[model samples]
Target: MTSAFIHLKASRLGRMAAACLAALALAVPAHAEKLPRLVLAGPAAAVSVPLIHMVETGALKEVADSVEFVTWKDPDQLRVLALGGKADFLAMPSNVAANLYNRGQPLKLLNISTWGVLWMVSRDKNLKTLADFRGKEIAMPFRADMPDIVFGLLAERLGMDPKKDFALRYVASPLDAMQLLITRRVDHALLAEPAVSMALRKTKSFPISVVAPDLYRSVDLQQEWGRLFKREARLPQAGITVLGKAMSNDALQAKVMAAYEKSLAWCQKNARQCGEMVAKRIDLLSPEAVADSLAASPLRHVSAAAAREELTFFFQQMLAKNPALVGGKLPDAGFYGNAGRP
Candidate 1:
């Protein structure tokens, strides 16, 4: 009877061990099946239309288990989100990213979202070029924004002190800038796409030039940077990025690139529809403004190679101006995604 009882106890122990192993095997695969959550940070304005398109069209949703968008009225808020790691994905200016990265912020640029959509609109014909704005009042969105920064750089390049040569009126938003320009409250205003287009449309009486208008124009910001540095530095605009802490998995990175590509394609194919969606969401203008803005803005398509080249040029320029833009060190190969060489 003792031998039989011992045999039964040994058999029960063996069965329990096998069941535990099987349970672990099942749980491991279940955990692996879980998807990472993606969060994109940007403003609700036209600058982030592409990102909004990606979410609305389900491109990001198809890759990640969940995706969330955080909107900020100010660009500083977006920068704070990236710095705090509260955002997995973010759309921000290249200069802002460079400043943050230089400050030891761990984030990798994914792709360029838009470029060259800024316009210097002014009613005063005397303000034809950057050099003409001496002791003049200009309305701008915020001091931290790329447009403002670019204007500052332009002023510096033209031998004008940013603090004393020109006076800047900080408008609460892009819309406010447009209003200030239309009502002639401000001498000149720096405007971005859709807002620029909307201002032109609303004030049919005013004529606005496209700033440099030509790629080789003397006042071209990119060309000026290149001339100063004697390097092929292009203006780095806006882009999508991922926090380094959130990009631990190689597979997640690949999915992000794929989603951005898909989203870009979707926006290009449905440009009109996307514009209509934006029009409805912002409640600012007619569908025509949406369509015209997308048509006129050169941010519709970006090849992977072109995007990298643009970023590389931007970094080179920033380094020339201030080496501390990239954390007192230049970005190595790790700062970019593995799509292709720029």
Candidate 2:
């Protein structure tokens, strides 16, 4: 009778286990179906290369059920998407993210994609330092943009006034500056990646003959920033960001970050193919130029939580430069999307 009772108890336990399993099986599909559909916005720049690779390789499939992508024509479109809540995630400039966060936008950076791609391209052979540009003209693009911000800080540190020490000839875009350089209208140009590559490709002295090669030996601003800020370990350029509304789900966020990280690795491994995609998808730059700019773009993927210290430094520096640049003050702990914080 005891053995029979034991058998009956075992049967009851098995039935309960089966019932629980059936409930879980029924819930998983419903939960998955309910997962938010993620819309990702990417700007047409080298910064979006990794996420582009993610989209191409179906890496996002590992995290999201359905992901729609919208390629932005310019930075303003990105701002519109953020303000309008049109996208759940976006890849944009790091400083822009900081500025937005400080302005009370519910934005949280995910990871940095590009370390630094800005370069000072000029024909000036004796262009040794910021002081050398005194009384000279530079083809500076995006008047108060990232490149200009860095230039201003470095010039001031060197005891020079950026506006007065160097004549900043502002242009509508980097391509315009490149055209100016080619036409011998400007001797120096501060160009971001892909633009630098494009300028090198379009120069008369490239791939066939060397005509005007002032853009030949461009100074990498990433290295320059490091040299100037000796205490900082990272350059922390631009990165991917997610809406604060999306960060509430830790599992989804982790999966997304993992997918993005994998995508970054894949991008580095298959730059040539990814460059072709970047060129064809958005017409941002030529395929050849994109391929060459991949390495120098300094693509990195550091989660916002892990990057807080360096980001704080960068934002604080910008705050020091112009209170408006970082929206008056450094962002609080809530600004980041780290597991501990969010």
Clashes of each: 1, 3
lDDT (10s digit) by residue, model 2, range 67-111? 766887555777898889888778877888888988999888777
* Least accurate 10 contiguous residues by lDDT in model 2: 205-214
TM-score for each predicted model, relative to the true structure: 0.74, 0.83
User: Taking the tens digit of each residue's C-alpha lDDT, what string does model 1 give over 1-342?
Assistant: 999999999999999999999999999876765457777777544546766676777666655677776776666677678767888777777666666766767877766666656667776554456677678787888664677766776677777887788788887666778778766677577776677767766665324333222111113444455666475534557776778555675566666666666665665667778777667656655556566667755563343345666667666655666665545555665666554123
Clashing pairs in 2: 205-209, 205-210, 205-211
Considering every candidate listed, which one attains the maximal lDDT?
A: 2
Model 2's alpha-carbon lDDT is 0.75
